[model samples]
Target: MSEANKDLMEKYMKEVALRRKYHEQLVELKGNIRVLCRVKPVLKEDQQEEGQAVVVTTDPNNESALSVINKGKARAFELDKVFHPQATQEEVFQEIGPLVTSCIDGYHVCIFAYGQTGSGKTYTMEGSVENPGINQRALKHLFNEIEERKDMWSYTVNVSSVEIYNELLRDLLSKDGEKLDIKINPDGTGQLHVPGLRVTEVKGFQHIKKVLAKARRNRITFGTKMNQHSSRSHALLCITVHGTDLANGSKTTGKLNLVDLAGSERVWKSGAEGERLKEAQNINRSLLALGDVIQALRGNQTHIPFRNSRLTYLLQDSLGKGNKTAMVVQVSALESNVGETLCSLKFAQKVCRVELGPAHVTISFRMTRDAMPYKTSQR
Candidate 1:
């Protein structure tokens, strides 16, 4: 082998040794795997009698239509009223930020969005371009916190996004073919070769916002009864955080995974057929696989079955097996979706029970030829 080949081989070997060490250390991490739920918005029916003066008799700050009519109780199993359902995306972020911040300050954290078909998972995670979503809100907040602590620390952050379809990686940014296989490098850097998909490094919020806006335009969408603009694909948006306390010089690496899972659907209920049918089946299949992994994780099963689906496999490292995870189960308040509502709540409940250990955030310090893994904080 040539000298260059020998160097690459040495680097690859070092990468493997580092991962093996990280894996072993992962067993000691104890995580805060929590799931939060958001309520969908609503509008009072246009004055039923078109020309009559409408006298509103209810409190503006009153409970949801269901809570009002159901005497403050709905069939949705994990329905929580401590937090409002129609809460804005920012409101939900406020409710969840502290919990996640706690993990980042020194713990492992994974935050993701989950819900049934058209229940507003997309709106909650990656909202309309006109109105920013959770990802945008979180990025802004992270930077704000960093700015406030400027005298005490310096931080670096990098982001990567990918879509897993049919157990394969489909680079949403790629202009070439439909899909490509992702090889997770031992150095903790993911490799992508799809003709059009690209991972851009972001230094500030503006750059990220621009990319997010473009990504929103490129996100997969399809029509359905629950939502005419429902998302047909899952998106994993990860922020790798690196911090060095200027005061103590204690370096910390942390990662916050914000996932917007494709809403789950049924053929009969969604009236999905043709390409829609295939998409629904693929979605349901992957979600079921996710459920299985969660179930096994809760029971402390030795074999996690992540290999069953691309979604689970890709999330393997973040779902309590290694990373500290959080899930926000979003549901619509309309009576039309009581069944889906309950299902989403239950999924969140199951997710809360799984354990996670200290998560060392993976970030690249510098690169001459390729990846160089470095560690950062617990929270």
Candidate 2:
């Protein structure tokens, strides 16, 4: 290393030590979090008005015998598109590259989507079968950035995916016919109990895509009245980034989580049967638990209650604990779903109130000053 390089290394080492000590002091400081609310374009047929905005002043119990039929179909572009038009589903895909890059640049990140059934959470998270989505786009970008910036930095990426099924954990990457159990340790690291759920380490985009395809096929999906192709289980796609700042020997570890939550549907509207009903119960219950956890965090309650739900327990390490978390709330613009949309909005509002600790990124510095050599001679 050149003299200038050595000096820089020494300076960085000192800075890292200082930051490590400060991390303890600032662990309680709130993190930077923001909510992005994207309004799904309303379909043409669902845009009809209630003719008279019908004044059904009937009973405190219910509206009987009279139904004000919407005479027209809703349009897809009825939403105020000024600032909220969804990224063409394509534009949205393009946005993930920079988001993941943010993590590699030394920020712990979590990006997840929330929306009602039939809304477009899957489309945003996994994308259309024919087109790529954010997950693919981000991985592709990570590799491309690595290859293109060969002289700048070298990266190693590892990815794993899992699903929360009825409060139980399942590995999404498991073999088609095999069942995998998920194990969570007290130290906070999780593992798949079954050997079939292989967490693969990937180098390039193609390999990552192949793994994603197989996982998607194995993901738990079920049909509901609200959405013909709704996801019955929650899916988590994670990418672990490992890199070395060749110039400064600053080793950084970053991770990005892309979560697709199960669709939210009412028991009456979904017309769920035995199995579907069970799935709905699990999903709604877990989501409620998550809400409570969020509320507790916002209130700074001594007892977080994360252990109350498996889903919340698994995420305890990520939220409020120095991870950069971003949530996009998706909602249909159609008035028919105003109730669901309202619920989603309220959830988003609650999420906005929650504060997070400053994002803490791990930086391991390997310096020549700290290096020691071992020499051996055999006689």
Candidate 3:
């Protein structure tokens, strides 16, 4: 072999050794499906008279428990973690950062934000551009780690953004609202494919930021009585990282799914009519299907109904047999919204009970020069 080829071989060997060490360490760590509750403070407009005070309170004795009082009656729910209304963006991400990093360790991971209309789900997942949110922060950290490990391994990153609107899958990165189909193979690998969806190869954080901006412009959003800017569809941002060992050509592919589900709302409560009513029904139906899937997993049923809805069908892989998952439930603290708040908390409570077996790393071997990974480029 030539001198350059010899050096590349040495680097690949080092990466292989590092990956094996990481796999051993990851196997020893416990991976639990977790649900975190976040309560948004009452807005100025939501402030009521003395008799109608905020109904939600964090338990002083138990940090993970919260009580919601309605009509002089109080109900309590417990979760893996609870963030009071006073919690900052940084504090929230601190709890979630580790889960995002697990993708770099070769585990498929999903993070979901679930709540009712007017709740803070959108704020928690995609904060203002000035402050940045979990998605942006996670991308920044992933690229940083990739740079730090460039000596031993090289990584290719690709991103795709899509939304489920009125029970149809639409690619948010496409020029128009292009419909996409979900394909499930019976190969026993639990693989899902969206054939025509646009996947952009992103070089770094800056590239991702631009792609996100373009996707946001194409996302479906509208005003509702509950909130001025309500997301009208369920949006999913998928990041695929393919890592290769320079010397041995050992490869690992990890997918990180960041989902922002459209707010779950009652049609009558949201005053839906005509097109709005149709959209609301579709959203609620898909969400109900998701809830059913979660319940089935928790019950360890013989058959999972992942095929019930397009959203669930698309997510069958990350949520099914061997992946790490986390959910952040956002709730409103206003007394008037107590009913919806309770429903959201109950859904989250059920989600916490569902468990998948320990996450497994995806590893493969290939010839060094013929690896053929996608080149990271700008749109």
Better of 2 and 3 by lDDT: 3
Best by TM-score: 3
Off by over 4 Å in 2: 1-31, 44-83, 90-98, 129-131, 184-196, 220-230, 247-250, 268-273, 297-302, 354-379
- Per-residue C-alpha lDDT of model 2 across residues 76-150, encoded as one tens digit per residue: 211111124334766565444445666665556667777787777877777776876667777777787778656
Query: By lDDT, who's the top model here?
Result: 3
Which is superior by TM-score, 1 or 3?
Answer: 3
Per-model TM values vs. the true structure? 0.66, 0.68, 0.81
Order the candidate numbers by lDDT, best to worst. Answer: 3, 2, 1
Prediction 1 global C-alpha lDDT: 0.60
Task: List CA RMSD, all candidates.
Answer: 16.1, 17.7, 14.3
Give the better candidate number (1 or 2) by lDDT: 2
Candidate 1 Cα outliers beyond 4 Å, as residue runs: 1-31, 44-76, 79-82, 99-108, 128-131, 175-178, 184-197, 220-230, 245-250, 268-274, 298-301, 350-379
